[model samples]
Target chain A: MGEIVLSACGLSKKYGLSYALDDVSIEIERGQIFGLVGKNGAGKTTLMRVVCGQSTLFSGSVGLFGHSGKRGLAEARTRVGFMIEAPAFYPKLSARENLKIYCMKRGLPVSENLDGLLASVGLPGVGGKRYSEFSLGMKERLGLALAILGDPELLVLDEPTNGLDPIGISQVRELILRLNRERGVTVLISSHILKELSSVATHFGFIHNGRLIEQLSSKELHARCSDALSLTVDDVEKACAVLENICGCRNYKIFPHNTIRCYDGAVRPELLNRELNENGVGVSSLMREGKDLEAYFIGLLKEGRANAQLY
Target chain B: MLNYIKADLYRIMTRPTFYIWPLLLAALPAAMIAGAGGMYPAGVILAAIPALVYAAFCLMALILTEHTFREDMQLGLYKNDMAGGASRSAVYIAKLITGILLLALLWAVCSLSCIVSASYWLGGDSGLSLLKDMASLQAASLFLRVNVFLAVFQAISIVFKKTSALILVYIAISAAMAYAMKWLGAAWPGLAGFIKHIAGFGAYGNFGAAAGAPHAAGGVALLLAPAACIIVLAAIGSMMFEKKEF
Candidate 1:
């Protein structure tokens, strides 16, 4: 419902004869922690690269902060920050020095909130240690710090927690939450860690084989993923009346072809089936199922594969 | 573009290679002074100074151009720069400007060391005369030649990201071309003469030749010719870089 921060439409990129991204369209709104979920080589990094202007020769239109095209995109990107694939810094320079270079390049004053930024990323007192000497988690932290420089409104992070320890991951998660909640920075983060993403993402975009399969808000995803009992019966009108009156179940949906799904977990299928039979609704089939984020993702991919085979 | 230049300069400053190479070259003049110990006449040292500085210029220019942009590319700093709102052309121009500025800084350091050592060991008056000649239009011609060579090296670095491979290819091509020209000159004089004029090093040779002779007309030609080459190569490099992916 907010202003659209990023809109990419009909993006297609190819290497040799293979398409890296094919007709991929994605949109990110203001103050959203949008999670991009996909497997390796599924065009996650490629899409991020194109959006940030790291890669070229792709056919598409990208609008950021209400601007598009070359000059407009460059102007729009002035307010964006990103770290793609891996964190890059001068190994010989210290953390502060590396950040100093970034700040200078962003045309920000060198003395503005640098120490605070480092501390926020849990890199306090790491002044003298060179980047080469730091651990992988430390490097990731520094990369995050660099991406947040100048208080950029939009942050595009690719596999930010790829090499982090548990503690490092939690710390980064907290920082991301604080940045989004307090500073209102919109985030487009990609990762293979589904549980971690499910914990923080306001919205999720599922990409498979270089195509976006689905985009949904957290509420909608949770609703679709919750446990439910799927039932098929004759006379769906009688089944709805029996479920509400006899089974005391109010949360259910009646579909066409006399199919009904009950979302209420406590509703017993045997009791519902008996009630439907008693109400003169012939019960054809009944099944109960539970689905979480992982199962849902696998189901989507499986369904996509099945459809591909059909064509 | 200014921000990109600043970031590049900062990166260059952090790397020891940038300062170490120039310092090593600057120490050469001091070494010459120490070895001479008045064994050779000051006139011989003064005459050798121009060639020594020219060699140092070429060495520093090559080293800086070979390492600066290629290292940044390998580190993926260009991606960071372009993501931070710098256009591809702007990033390319920034690297070119940084290389030129670094070359100037290194050259100044070496030239200063030579001046100081010559003044201390060879006496003040002769050193002043050497400085005067170095400040002349002939020295400007030499600087222009170095710029052209640096631009060529930069273009090579842009096209070929591998540093060692680039160095080998550059040296091989230059040596092969020089040898081929030499052979042709011996075998067929007229054709060889025409090829030499079109060779990439023609302006460099002219500048070097004019350094000793101090011909005004040749100096002017040397100035314009290398400047033109540098502009064309720089434009081509920029276009290629703009189309480059990552």
Candidate 2:
């Protein structure tokens, strides 16, 4: 594990009686792009708000840069930058002027390459334009610039690509990758765009109904999603008998119409086909089946709901 | 906290209201002088000027609050400050300080304009003498009133999260309390003395009596009401702010 930059344990926030965040605990190490995936109102934004100190925690502790107490956490936050929800700025003020307010607030010199920073975010030459004049994509780009304003060690962005075109999304993805690779900044980003998130995230956390159901590395997720081998046969009963007795394929599920899917990663498809054929079971179709990020999350949600129902 | 104050001041100056308000304030007296002419003596006119300016000062307090803090909750500026490592108390106090600073600046400008304009346009030593006599007490009264107004408006803004609602609620409560206190005080004489300290409306009589009596007993006695409100309201506001989630 790399050095842990952000950690939250038993975090919960409540509104009236409903829990916005229910005992969510997550840890993001340095140089890791941690992607938070959830449906709307699943507590993704709530968790980000709590971590950024925008909301008070009902119960739990958050440690940033190894700091936990109020003052320590506050001091730790100086090294962090975030952009949660819609990017808000003084509408009448120009983009540069809006950024200058933050610069002054953060004690950065007003002359600190604000135009260069704006240009870096793909907002070149528009720093003098009023914020209200900019399009939604421009606003999102400005938000990204603000998140990286202080060259922070940890960047927390909630739906950074919320209202952007395909080109804009790709640019944001490349920017995140470049920041992580070159500057070694840890990022905790939440997005509904699972495909975009999957492309950039080094780790994933799946949240459902305010609960974090699973957390895993990208490599582990890929392995879990690709391990299934689907097969079809002439006779389901004969194939199952041969697989159980000869091929030793025990971890498998049978579906209707003579189809079976094997979850056992050790079950070699070539060997199983030969064994089934020799045992007088004809093999008709065989292929590897894998889930993309979206399907994997949906399957996880289903399993989570099923387990919840079981208890 | 200092950084917040600095940033807030920068934003405040960017607004057109900051400049428009003072000019508009100065225009009020100019209009009075233009129309009233020699019908009222310089002494009478100059003596009445503080009341006019202070009344406007009260309205200016509300406007300043609207401009400075109206967008805090609406635009999530407080979120930016808190997320940048400022404590809630720090943010609240920073806003308080910013409002107070701007109010003082406006007070200075208005005071100067009234004094200089009266001296220039309203002739004679009588007008100047009248202003000098009432300056200290009026300043004190204005200071206390403006601070109290600012504290109450800020508290309302933070708790309610709506600027228009803040203005309406403040006006409603002030009016309601004034009438209630008058009725209650008339029916029960003993409650008047104690009730006067309970609300800011009780201080209205002090401003008129305080004119020309540089250090009047009424003015000194009225200080306790607003000073206490400033402290209590600020403490409550800060505490509530600390508990507030964004």
Candidate 3:
């Protein structure tokens, strides 16, 4: 509702035999953390490149914030800061110097910008510290700082935390959240870490085979993945017999050891246990269960692949 | 665009390669003086005759500019910069400024050397007056023209995305033009008269033909011709770059 910051109309990029992106379309609302999830070679990077104008869109159109003309693309680019792949910098220059050069390149007001930008990324006091000396985590932070140099309204980060350690990854995750929540900046991010992605994304675009398999909000996904009742009993055989006899136990799964996962979305645990106890089965534990994103995602992917094979 | 141009000049001027070129060029005239010291006062007039000797020197600046282009692209710096609102023309002009700066550095070195080498001669300049000599002025002017020419060559070098090919083609064209100009100069004597005069290539012919009427004209003509071609070539290259898929 705030306004679409990025909208691609039939965006397609083909590399001869392989359709890198086939008629891909998505709209990103301003100030939203938009997640682009795809398998390897699913056109995530290619879509990003086309949107960034790094590579021209081979088919269809891209309009950035109501500005799609050449001048519009040019102006929109200034407002978009991207770290496409590995951060590029002069190996000889320090992180600060690289930022300074980037500032100069963009003609941004840089009186105190470099210091503030560096500190914002947790790279403080990196005055004469040459960029070559910085660790991968540090480099990724510096690259983020550079992307944020102009205080762009939108950030396009392609695997920002790709190769970072757990700590580094969390730090980047926090930084991204702060950028979006605190700064009110729209973000389009692509990564392999689905759990981390789900934590931040307000909307998701799941792509496969150069096409968007699905696009849904968190509430929508949560609702669609059938909820279940989970139970942990001391005697799995007893719970299985009790469940099989119950009216709603036909679809339940007896997990390894002493757990039975019930797929009946509306069945309450108290009622289920009371019915089981009345049937001469004692229960130790019972709780309602819901499908996790990973499970739901796998189901969707399998469904998509099955459909593709059919066609 | 102006900011990008300024930033590019700053980057080029600070580079060690930029300073190295002019110093190498400055040594050329001095070497000329050292080879034929006191043998001919006329040699003073003929001292800097082999202008094309430093063509290779200018080629070095072209190489550096091409290298900068390659580095910017490789470093993803170009991606970052272009991601901003900077125009492709701005980048092309930046290359021109870099080439000019390198040429300026060469001029400074040559001016210094011409003064020192001329000093050991009977009619050499002394102190601050060394740079004021007419031959030093000529060398400075030629160096300026060379920078402009190099800017164009460097810009075109990137258009083809290869430095060696453009440099080779550049040298081949220069040689071909020289030969063709001479052959044409004999037939109508005025066939390409306007082009040659515009180029000023015939102003100051090499010293062995130092006093020939064509030499002085060739020197002045060389002043503008290549530079003009460079400017035109740079413009074309800029358009190509803006439209080409980088």
The TM-scores, one per candidate, come to 0.85, 0.88, 0.82
* RMSD from true fold, candidate 2: 4.0
- Considering lDDT, where higher is better, how would the candidates rank from best to worst? 2, 1, 3
Consecutive 10-residue window with the lowest summed lDDT within model 3 chain B: B204-213
Error of 2 at B178 (Å): 2.4
Candidate 3's residue-wise lDDT over B146-192, tens digit each? 55556556655555555577767777776787788988888868756
Give the poorly placed runs of model 2, Cα more than 4 Å off.
Answer: A229-263, A267-288, B130-135, B161-164, B183-199, B203-208, B211-225
lDDT by residue (B1-246, candidate 1, tens digit) is: 888787878778877666777778789987897678479988777767767776667666677775567777877777888888888877777777888888778777877887788888889986787687667666676676677777877888777877678778778877887788889989997666544443345434333346554333555664675677778878988998887788
Task: Report the lDDT of model 2 for residue B196.
Answer: 53
List fnat per candidate, in order: 0.88, 0.83, 0.67
The TM-score, computed over Cα atoms with residue i paired to residue i, of candidate 2 is 0.88
Top-scoring candidate (TM-score): 2
In candidate 3, what are the lDDT values of residues A94-170, reduced to their tens digit?
Answer: 77767776677777765746877788777789856988898888888888888888888999988888668897788
CA-based DockQ, model 3:
0.54
Individual DockQ of the candidates?
A: 0.70, 0.69, 0.54
lDDT of 1 by residue, A235-278 (tens): 88888888888888899988888788898977888888777777
TM-score of chain B of each: 0.82, 0.85, 0.70
Top candidate when judged by lDDT against the true structure = 2
Q: What is the C-alpha lDDT of each candidate?
A: 0.81, 0.83, 0.71
